[model samples]
Target: MPEHLRALIVIVILATAVFSLAGKTATQLIPARDFKRRRNLWFALTLLAFLTHSFWLYAAAATFCLLLTRRQEHTPLALFFLLLFVMPPATVQIPGFGLINYLIKLDHPRLLALVILLPAFFTLRRQPGVIRFGRLWPDRLLLAYLLLVALLYLRETTLTDSLRQSLYLLIDVLLPYYVASRGLRQLQDFRDALLAFTLAAMVLALIGLFEYARHWLLYRALLGALDIEWGLMGYLGRGGSLRAVATAGQAIVLGYILAVAIGFYLFLQGVTTSRLQRWLGGLLLAAGLFVPLSRGPWIGAAIMLATFIASGRHALKRLFLLTMAGLLSLPLLMIIPGGQKLLDLLPFIGSVEKENITYRERLIDNSLIVIERNPWLGSVDYRKTPEMQSMIQGQGIVDVVNTYLGVALEVGLVGLMLFTAFFVTILQGIRQALRRLPRHQNEARNLGRALLATLCGVLVIIFTVSSISIIPVVYWSVAGIAVAYVQWVRLQTQPHATLDR
Candidate 1:
């Protein structure tokens, strides 16, 4: 808000764009180390600029471009980026002051349209590439989902929310599938798309981390200005120290993403050479996860760890690593003064944990209450919830913490039922993939395991977080990739089984 700060942010944005252009282009031409350094500089600048939340859009756009260009080797990277964006959400936040706040806000839609849709637009323009639409694994279900959401929206009070929901499905989910189905019909294309996505995430995360730190410095400076009268609003605006959630919305989303990265790395580790190298890679990923200490991600991390420990053959190594890491971080966790301070929230957490809690319980309770009054299909409105609006007006605002419940609250029972089916079908896909994996194919098996772990992690986070706006991008992107992988695997196993043949 301050003139100096605003100038600082604008300068940071320009600097970032320059670094991005240079780094991305140079990485193509120069040494890998040099490329990483250039990207690191861009990241550092982005972090410095996060205080104003301006450069984030630029970062997101830059990332989308970088990946779109480097289409060759990025699936693992894309999955990693997806995880990074998932937890430690991509919203703004300052630290160690004020309300100890959390907010679920997405980046601007216009930028998103430019970043995501433009590529599809270009693809569409070049040639008439048709999708052999056979009620595909996800496509069939996605349409059903669209229809159900539309119905709920048609009857809803908040027309704008419905519009966004439809837009998210059409753009994020459908566009990617449409583009990928044509673009990634081949096995290599599938891998390339995923890798490109991963690279994009790393680029953005590095920048987000950079700007996150910059915002922290600014927050500390502001806190210093406040001196004795510490404020909550400023810190809440910036997010906490664990990670500087940039365009991804929240640090939890960021953490979840980092966890997903870990999952990918674990998959890679199972196949990569040298045990020591694998250990280092795993450590690097775990360190990445800790940057955003969101509880949802913590839960997600636990899920990932459990999966690793139960991965049968690989259990010993992963469990050993986790055991060692836990034993070590425990001392640090205990000695930290702030770690214990969080105990004060035990009552609130416990209250929320109760069979009938506040945010979680309230949504379920309200929805059921509404349903009871009008059981036959239930009342629906396109307008914002009057009850929620009052609360928002009273204390800014928040969402139904649970993602599934949030949808229910937004669209009522029918929407909830359909969404539940959509998710269940996705999980079913994962299960089928896991079962169908060839016994001797380590790469496919490990990859499938990693995907399964990530899906589980995401599911856990959604249960406790209102990640609606993010789900289409987050879930659907992976769903598309999963579809690609399945097609790829089936082709690899039984090569001549194509419709074209």
Candidate 2:
């Protein structure tokens, strides 16, 4: 058989298993009766295009999303999250027509957002508004941050290039946020959208586990068939073991996605009644989290859990129990075969790649020196600095692993402040919303807590890696959910407002 055919076969088999395992449970978690109908056909069609290396895959996915939206079969938000990680980020650049000589690049998620969520954004603007976009402080901060970056980019590039970058920001960043914040108006919308994210992450998790076991980058062949040069598509390893990248393009990115998924699973497991199902789901997620072997996400997962616990009732007692569990598990983990090696791979205490931690420290120190040269508005040639030159790896590239430091280097302290304040505002809103909710409305409160914890995890995780791949999009959409949750809580407190819908 041909290589493409073999790749397609593997994709189909794994996709089937993912659907079979996650479909029924997803349906049960979904409170909306309309969404309970069969989802198999859509996944089948999407898989054909995604794995078969079809040039027309973008059009097919976009058209199907539009059709679903036209028929009210799936909300734009649900479709976006469901298909977010289904396709690898192998982009194809379409040649420009007429006055535009530059190329326009897009991947599956960007096309879906443009086709489905972009229109939904305009429609949302037309609706009689309960809460307007700029009404929230985070909204303003986000816009300001974008504007600042756009200006900085324009200063360093041609008009045409600046416009292209701006368009990317619109489609990739704003569209996801707008659709998520506005489209999810009810409780079921929240459940459906989040469940869609969890299911998609579940699919990636399963694929990651398989790749780890097989020592193969499964989607790497799909890229070869499509003739796309995605930089992160190649294999990565740690401690002589394959770190599964799956569709995320990088192992760290995949681990970040799984960490966020586990955070969502915490909220999702609350809705299901079957103890066995919940345990199975948790085990699957935990196993998935392990395969990537990204220590950053491991730390982030711990922070997420701690935040989730701290935000809930009886925080101290629950935290103590969690600590006791960890303390007790260490001894048991040490006794297992290869457990000592696994423990050594952990962050801060890890012996494997301890140099990476040193590199990050030097990166921060050197990056600070670069920032100090022009602290207000960063230099466009920051990459050419002698300080950065000294830190170049064997690959001959200065890897800015820290997202926060990257922002500071590119756009300066003002841009960094705007970006930081954006999430900080969202976190504040979620906390306030949780406070206003009644104790009887446990589910809503839990969802708020989950988003809060997830956002916190994202903020911390990105510090260990740059805002690359799906990392930024995941954080952006999660922040949108936090804003939506805040609005929903406000709606519930209002007179004659119904939240169950």
Candidate 3:
């Protein structure tokens, strides 16, 4: 056979395998009662995918086996949480061709999976008593913001780019909110979803600890095997200690995830009646928060802790005691031989890294100039603009680290306001939920408090870093759940109000 013909045959075979796996995965999302009939076939395909070392195929199959076989209600939320934990970072190369890479970012897979499950979500929405949209300010604000995004897309560099950007907003921002509001109806549903996140956090935290101690990322070899090269794999902190990325691609992202997990665990600690469960979970997450060695998350965690304590719950005293203990031990730690080393591991402890600080300042300064140049409607895609490309060449800065500036650059002041309004409205919903709930509804109240603090921490981190990836989906999902919780509370309290159609 001709070599060219053989290469074509190989390409066809690879494409068929990829599509077949994707189709099988999508089939698992079907809300059918005869799932048992296809059990053997699904299992066989999953094993085949694994044997073939097809990362996404194996992942989809494994996720289905673990969560999909259970209650249909749990599958969607559980799958979302699992994706956050397991999905490889952005821009992983395909196995055979180094130039051709698989963009395994959390958002893309999540968008595809959720798109497949849209019918199920729609069916759930049609059910009576399901909490749909209410006259919530945040919902209105979010809608307005989405509309602005759509309008701005028309001014994008190319029609193709405009359409792509618009679709991404719909998928990552709007769709997650829709699913959370429509799919997660009951309080127990929210609990189950959070539990999945807590479990994933624990696993990632352990991985982070291992990576930190070994000074090597365990996933890098696996990633390299798949031709995935992470540019930030060699990040080092003070004392030349390796910064932990865990399953999150970068230190900043892992820090954000850890910070959010700390909030969730704190909620569990606050509300759980079981003493053992409370202490064990809280301590694990606290330790996990330190492994990333990123200052942003540490600060976020502190802020979250402060907020959680201020909620005036009985758990405040316990957390306060824990904080006091850590503070008191600082001097003692300094006295020990390796204590200074440990203290240096913490961000902003000793001499600060001048290079990182300088780069951030430069990036922020350049971002302001770009925003100034294209204040209205932004520059469609600033990255494609000559000015930004020149900055990238000159300063070696690819993206603006700050979220607010990033948004302003993308869609101008109008977009930034709409974005701010969306989050503010969500926070307002949370505050209202806390005030309206009766004393007996402690679980619901605690959940609201947790989410509020989590949002606070996330906002703090994003101020210094961009929230452009799958991380924002996590925020939106949590926001959706908060809105859903408030809506449920309002429906219960207000006798005359009916579910929105």
Per-candidate TM-score against the hidden true structure: 0.65, 0.95, 0.78
The residue-by-residue lDDT of candidate 1 on 105-166, one tens digit each, is 24433234345454554554465433354456466666766777666665653565566557
Q: Which of the predicted structures, 1 or 2, would earn the higher TM-score when compared with the native?
A: 2
lDDT of 3 at 44: 43
lDDT of 3 by residue, 169-212 (tens): 77677777777766766676666566556655665676677667
Reference-based TM-score, model 2: 0.95
Best of the candidates, lDDT:
2
Best of the two (1, 2) by lDDT? 2
Clashing residue pairs in candidate 3 are none
Across residues 361-476, which tens digit of lDDT does each residue of candidate 2 receive? 99999999999998977878899999999988988899999999999999999999999999998999999999899999989988998998999998999999998888888888
Q: What is the lDDT of residue 15 in candidate 2?
A: 68
Cα RMSD, model 2: 2.6
lDDT of 2 at 461: 95
**Candidate 3 deviant stretches above 4 angstroms:** 1-51, 59-71, 91-108, 115-120, 131-135, 228-238, 271-274, 313-329, 345-349, 381-395
Lowest lDDT 10-residue stretch of candidate 1: 224-233
Ranking by TM-score: 2, 3, 1
For each candidate, what is the lDDT? 0.51, 0.82, 0.64
